[model samples]
Target: MIAVLTSGVALGVHVPGLLLASRLRERDVPVRVEVLERLLPPDRLAAVSASRDVFHRDFRVARVGQRIASDPVAAISADVQDELVRHWEECGVHTVVVFSGFWLSLVRRFMERTGRAPRVIVCHVDSVASPSFRKAGPALPGTEEIWLASRAGTALPWTIPVTREPPIQWDRREPRLLVHGGGWGMGTYRDRAADLVDAGHDIDLVVHAVEETGPAPGRTRHFVLNPAWHPWLDDGYPPLGHLLPGRSPADVSYTRGRTHHSSFDLARAVRAMVSKPGGGTLLDSLWSATPLVLLEPSGEHEGHNAQLWCDLGFGVRYEDWRSDAFSPRLLEKMHRALLSAAEGPRDLAAALSGSEVSLCSE
Candidate 1:
């Protein structure tokens, strides 16, 4: 089987997709992540697989070499065809697991015609509030079904709502605070770091700092603000796409690095996690048992992500990270979560934990 992850998609979707794929591979089920042309920014995709320890073994991967700025769908279709032809001829692939948004007609043709092409499974790895909006429309005939990550509802092929496994209950060690740069570094991350320090939380800030944005200036014991934490977040990191501009550090990071041992190690670590209901990263925090100080990005997704966690009674949010009114809300929550960490709903915590992403074909 071959699994293809598209560009600019959600890490929540991809993490589970890859975990599922890995499980299949363990069963001697051959799996490969098809690198599509327009699916994502090449460098960003590379960074994700590279930073995560998952890039090992034969993996049977293929790369689709086309540019997205020109024509995204066409580039994706071309690459899929190329991979299909090669895999069909060499491996007799039995299935094609694709993670993407908006299906293309040409891809449908390849799935329909490829000899032993295998069942085509396409999953849209994004929050229901993703831009594409149309969730079920991208699925094709060969597609087994679409997997919905956030909500537990009627979707289709598979409906797994955040397959977060339980984490080993640690006795709330030192306050471990994890901050992500999303797929794009919004230049305001420095403020986040500053706020935590100002509040005397003594945080360990991890970010994938874009060169132009430089690094956050402050004193944190373990500050990792680089484009190298993608894979370790365990939530899967989405490709940066146009989110981060200029240099292509993501690809450089992925092609050369190994799996990160810590969460503070990638570009876009969390997707759309919502254990409490806001977004992917916050959920990851709950799963990792790390207390959170939710930063409100200007976008709806970030606000929604922040709100989810807040509603679930987990984390606190600040509209402006650089204000006198930053408040001690997050600090209070962290202490509370840590003190009663063992007493909280283990299921809810598990729902925030990370699962290896994989594709299914049953």
Candidate 2:
């Protein structure tokens, strides 16, 4: 049996966990899943239920310690080591998959002691779009194999094979737009929605903000304010506090809030995805071949991602958060992205709409 372990969060890594479970199950491979405890509220759990039934129904669910869940990496690696040992022994699993932050000394020691530990694989979901090597070295020598949601120049050099397949999603329809700021809800991306609404862009708006509560802007047709969506769709917006302001509402459809639960195909069919860079949402948008408009108030990661697409002739980028820049810039680039998207997967748009996954070989 192959055991998959991860933190039960709404983030992108969960996608691959679910996909791995589904992939193994299809092959009749016995599989189980254990998550580092991060007790989710009932509503968030419901959203998770809607988006992913794999971890819930297909695989076994186990939890690590409360301290590890609350203060990972900093919570004394030895404690984590002890818990993993206990968990591993109880499961009597052969292969194990781990998805979490950087390696801890405890983890390394555990691997050493366990000797020939499960055929471990680490999957990276971060798509910050920057080429910085600071965050790329950890999972390299520590695991037997590594997978990524999108390919990067760094991956090949580092000997990490990347894959294009996203986690198995239950919903298969194209959505008008999708908006969520991540776990903290608008932690830093809240202003982007307000800016768009202030501009009168009469589009659907969905907000999963801090306190899971926020004022719904004018353009939102369907609102999911202060709510959680499964698979943590908050990467759809900028990180935190980087919203653009000033433009009048242009004619655009907008929807905000978590769609990880709904299976709306915005990533697959969005005219353009606007957000700060450096997360799975960016990769999802690219895979959908959806054009991209990267807005960054600070981190150049989003800009770098936009540059990557721009280099591929797929999309455009905007550094400032002014309404003037976004209004005209988005209008032009969104059009270009849509046009380019029609051409093929070589660009962002085509990847989103045209790409297909072959389950048997997946």
The most accurate candidate by lDDT is 2
- Candidate 1: residue 287 Cα off by (Å): 3.5
Per-residue alpha-carbon lDDT of candidate 1 for residues 261-315, written as tens digits (9 for 90 to 100): 2342221132111122223444345444444555544344445555544554455
Lowest lDDT 10-residue stretch of candidate 2: 58-67
> Candidate 2 on 186-247: residue-level lDDT in tens?
22344555666675544444444232324445535433322333333322322222122332
Clashes of 1: 35
Cα lDDT, all candidates: 0.40, 0.42
Q: Which regions in candidate 1 have their CA more than 4 angstroms from the true location?
A: 2-4, 8-18, 38-71, 76-83, 102-106, 115-117, 132-138, 142-148, 151-170, 209-261, 264-283, 297-304, 319-362
**Stretch of 10 with least lDDT, candidate 1:** 58-67
Question: In terms of TM-score, how similar is model 1 to the real structure?
Answer: 0.56
Most TM-score-accurate candidate? 1
